[model samples]
Target: MPESLKKEIGQFNVFYIDYDNHDKGYCQSYRRRGFYKISLLEGETKLFYADKTMTFKRYALLFSNPNIPYSWELTGNNHTSFFCVFTEEFIRQFGMIKTYAVFKPGSYPLFELSEEQFRAFKDIFLAMQREIASDFLYKYDVLRTKVLDLIHAALRLQPVGKLPNKEANSALRITSLFTELLERQFPIESTLQQMELRRPAEFANHLSIHVNHLNHSLKEVTGRTTSQLIADRIIREARSLLQHTEWNIAEVAWCLGFEEASNFITFFKGREKLSPKSYRNSKIE
Candidate 1:
């Protein structure tokens, strides 16, 4: 067992991996208790992740945030890798880990690296090895910054998408991220998990931008205000739930964050021109 894996329970842990130790390495993924992991592998493997499945060869970067379940199945002979696991509390300065495209579900978190890029990343991991092993003061602080560098650099490498309008401008980019965050929350997989960030301000808070700024960016890029966008999504989700699931109207309302079933009914009627029950009944009929 690696020392870092057994090290004193704390907010931060870092180490290069030994592939044979499957329990302690990045080779397996599941819903972690609280920590987030970032890893780089040097060989081929099949990735089974919550949002998608993929296979990678040569060099790959893998990111695992809490609640985003993932696992790895080795396919090639070599499985050398380095990874670090740390809690959100470990780096007080950094938040919005979710906003990073790499950590978001349904986005490609694993990237095959070119030889040159692979060496560059390997260098970063090597530095992490040296830093964590050293007795230097403020080593954790230094390590945190290095990890941030690794994360942001990887994010910059993600191929640009059309929706974010990277070609348009900064505001448009922010708007795109906001839209994606909203979309990722649903089709509401089960009635058990309640929806969050159902309001514009919640999203603005998550994006670390002012609500007005978020609304302005969204309005400019989408021609719809932030509230409008959120409402549209909620209505879309509500419609899907009503039309498909056998859950009662109250249950559907609860999943979408409505406090009372009547409130859900009024909201649905105003938007869809039919009550939730009526809509569901229509679908059934």
Candidate 2:
């Protein structure tokens, strides 16, 4: 949000945060920002992702996807970091950004870094900063290449594993289809666009399968029932809307398929142990 520290080129922007000027601490609750972010942290910090917490004692790389809600704060220690924020449209030509594992919905996007590794990434961010302020006509192209470099470097840092051989499995295929259908209804772009499939029966009907068949496939693959999975994902979206959106309880309820605000209150309290308003207030500064 600092105007001077940010350098923008098209939909991409990079920022510099130095130790002396770093704010004491701040939290950004999850919301759909429709942008991707990559940050290089150079001190102690704590990251809060959906249902997970990770601490970094020194250097670390964090990748954020617009679909996932995450936040980080300095742990009362001196910190210096550089970050870049860009929309999917900014780099769509390079590749399908979501195909990368780091930006996947249930991925561990944080990576601890050595001094050498940190400096390598820091150099890319610095180059981005300089390029954005340059007068060159094709500087945006250069920045796009630099962004890919950062992504590839982070991928290398990840632990490599032997991939399993592809095999035909009907249950797995059904589960995959179910997951796609479930994800397609997410981010709840507007109040007018209410969720149409909040139940396994509805999802099964859309997939042209029986509700029992869909439930069995999901349970076999994910070790959880279909209804449970739907509820979990709904709760996550509800939390995000509560924390980040100005829509009142009634609007949020309707957006998530609850016909009444009271029904939403009861549903939210059952899972989160607090009312939606209280959850929103807890995130307020």
Candidate 3:
């Protein structure tokens, strides 16, 4: 965190910047703040995302939210994209987060375009660049609406099965809230940050429900127990931290909520068949 007054940043912000390369797209300066990011990108792009690596070849429409951890690199072509980022605060003022599938997990992140699709998306992005450059009042309002139009437009091209219907069912709704709450605990980007919810009961208490009820909803919807889901996600993040970061075993353990480093070592070895240090070393080798 920046100590100076000049360094404290506002929750609602936007940017249009150029990428330094395909491998790091304007990534050197920006700290992730769980913002909603939209980019109309060209070239072969790679995104290291959520324990997976995915690549887009030449022209893709991309959307991402802060709950996901990702890094973008270009493998070919100049990085030319119109990028915009806004926080949950911006969305909350005009729309509910739950209403937009664009920010949620399992949300569609890329739309591979047909020639017709490419032309249509290109118009919208060009219009965005033009309208945002104007000094007119309420331009951001127009811009916000345009962003929604783009999201809904890309959403239409997705297979109907992949899109979530209105989630009015009470059990499904509860499960959604649980999963969102669960996902919010992750992407563990900083050494100073720590997991806030480590146990099912703790999550249940925070959700104003009984532990048994939370477990039931999750199992009913996902066919997995609450503890299983939590453990799986923690292990996924553990592997990512081990492979990608220079944080030592003790620091990694502390970030994941282990009071004793030995406990983390045991938990990791049980699941991964190796100590954290061994796994990390293996990654480098």
Candidate 4:
């Protein structure tokens, strides 16, 4: 993360993509960015999300949260679009953004937009850009509404279903807390910034609950065990460090809570089918 960006976690920025001014560096790698992003893409593109590949030949709206690791490639000539990136603090007053399905963990955040819908969304983004640049007072208030507009617009596209029951909603809330806690420890920027919560019991203890209770809550909502979720997130961070940083395997292991490089290698290989060094080399090639 850039130093300037690190200081502006509460700020937001909007942009209109001029192909001439577009930079591929922004979409170059699958890593957890320090902020959230919502983009309206108007060209052919391939999105490589963790364990999933989605190719969009036309228009698509992509919602990226700080927790997920992702990257994209432009496959077509036309690269015009609109996008806005903001940190959680930028919209913290609205509510927990992760509670929404599009930003929720394990949910696919991409939405296909029709031409008409695209036009409408374009208007929203343009409005946001305009408002953000204006000298008017309470412009941020207006921007917040526009952000919610974009989210609600995508929600409308999703198939309607029966509302989640009370019990399920309770489970969902616990899942959201677990997801937030897990995400808070990420984007690990340095070797000295070792992870403090690497075990399920530690997380549960921190939350003042039993380990089995935490596992039950996660399983109820995500259908995955607590250990599985923790391991998956560790793998994600390990991959990011391997590809995006110059850290050696041992450094990566230490940052991720593995005391020894061999143990880290074994853990990574068991999940990824490739050693950390091999994965990094593959990305380089």
Per-candidate TM-score against the hidden true structure = 0.51, 0.57, 0.52, 0.57
User: lDDT of all the models against the reference?
Assistant: 0.74, 0.78, 0.69, 0.78
- The total of clashing pairs for model 2 equals 0
Name the runs in model 3 displaced over 4 angstroms.
1-30, 159-176, 179-200, 204-285
Worst 10 residues of 1 by lDDT: 159-168
lDDT by residue (95-137, candidate 1, tens digit) is 5555677765345567778888889888888898898788765
Task: In model 2, state the lDDT of residue 205.
Answer: 92
What number of clashing residue pairs does each candidate have, in the order they appear?
0, 0, 5, 0
Estimate the overall C-alpha local distance difference test score of candidate 4.
0.78
Candidate 3, residue 276: the lDDT equals 93
- Give per-residue CA lDDT, model 3, range 1-285, as digits (tens): 233212213433344445554345424213464467777776677765433456767777777765445567677556667666766645555766556766555554666666677677778777767776776555566766777778788778662123234432444556667777876877799999899898999989988989998887666545568898788778988998999799988899999999899999999999999999999999899
By lDDT, the better pick of 3 and 4 is 4
Tell me the deviation in Å of residue 241 in model 1: 36
Q: lDDT tens string, model 4, 1-285?
A: 555334443577788876646665247432334467888988778886543577767788988876556678886576777888876656778976776788875566788777888899999999998898786667777887898999988988852132235665555556777888887897799889999999999898888888888888787655578998899889988988999899989999999999999999999999999989999999999
Residue 280, candidate 1: Cα error in Å is 48
* Model 2: per-residue Cα lDDT over 198-234, one tens digit each: 9889999988999998887676555578988889889
